[model samples]
Target: MELHHKLRRDPSWHPNACNICGQLGHQAVNCTNGTINWRQIYGDEAFTIKPPVFWSEMADKQKKKEVDVKELARRAREYARMQCQAQGIDYDEMIRGAQVFQHAPEQKPQLPVTSQQNGGSAGGAVKKEAPEGDLPEGWAVARDAQQRVYYWHKKTQKVQWDKPTKDTPVS
Candidate 1:
């Protein structure tokens, strides 16, 4: 008892209590109580402990949603088949036509057609023939596959869609 009293009286002798749970025998850094008594540690401000998130449960829910979507798709297909049968339409042919329409290339609006003798080109471009000797010096006229007339300046190596005359800039 004297040795114990002496040891307790020693300056190095100290007792440890957890700042988290206010329990003896452990410091806050070494606390292992699994839960902290916040009211005992931090004066009386209310605190709520949130539950831990489980990623596996979230992944399971996502997989279940995917299965439900697949089931809905199957039901829709069966309903469509029944409707087609009632209408006397071939279901497979109708499905194939729908898929073809979905995957088919888009169509472009068509231009009006005119006979080639009327200056209509193969590519639907309307062209007019320029009179010979109408081009300025160093400029020559050429026709594209569309029969569209284009002008080229030989000295500048410049090409233009419009016929180049003396008033056309060199550039």
Candidate 2:
């Protein structure tokens, strides 16, 4: 009997399983139904849906965010390394002093000198020797290891590495 009909006939009776095949939701008549999920008919992916575009977009955004973070972290490490080198602190001694051994060095790992371009108020400038004519008047450009470009206003000594606001000039 149908679940509804059985319920009507006996109020105490409960439909715990399928009334047709006495199994789960599957029925004997529709056991081979291959419209919704074709896994019943075929064993491979037949017509899978395209993943949401935002998944790739989010991944790109995340990659950009990671590069930005690495750039900023590189700046900080350069500053620390400079200060330590000035104080004549050896790399091993500084590492022990900072107790960085407990954590992943990935956070403060030393970046290659070639990774830096511009050198001024921003860290990593020591490795960069910008030629006078290479840059426009009162303007500088720095590139990090990730190849992320940073625009420098030499006049104001201001550096912009991320998306610019409307106030920033297009040129």
Estimate every model's Cα lDDT from 0 to 1: 0.69, 0.56
Best by TM-score: 1
Please, what are the lDDT tens digits per residue for candidate 2 over residues 64-162? 777577878989889888988898878568768668667745654444433234333355433333343545556666766644466678667777653
lDDT, candidate 2, at 67: 54
- TM-score of decoy 1: 0.29
- Please, what are the lDDT tens digits per residue for candidate 1 over residues 1-171? 246644434344344444445566866444666366546677554445567779998899888777577878999999999999999999999999999999999976645546553344355445657555878889888776655576788899998765667899997
Q: Give the least accurate 10-residue stretch of model 1, judged by summed lDDT.
A: 5-14
In order of appearance, the predictions have TM-scores of: 0.29, 0.20
Clash pairs detected, candidate 1: none
Give per-residue lDDT, candidate 1, residue 140: 83
The alpha-carbon lDDT assigned to residue 51 of candidate 2 equals 64
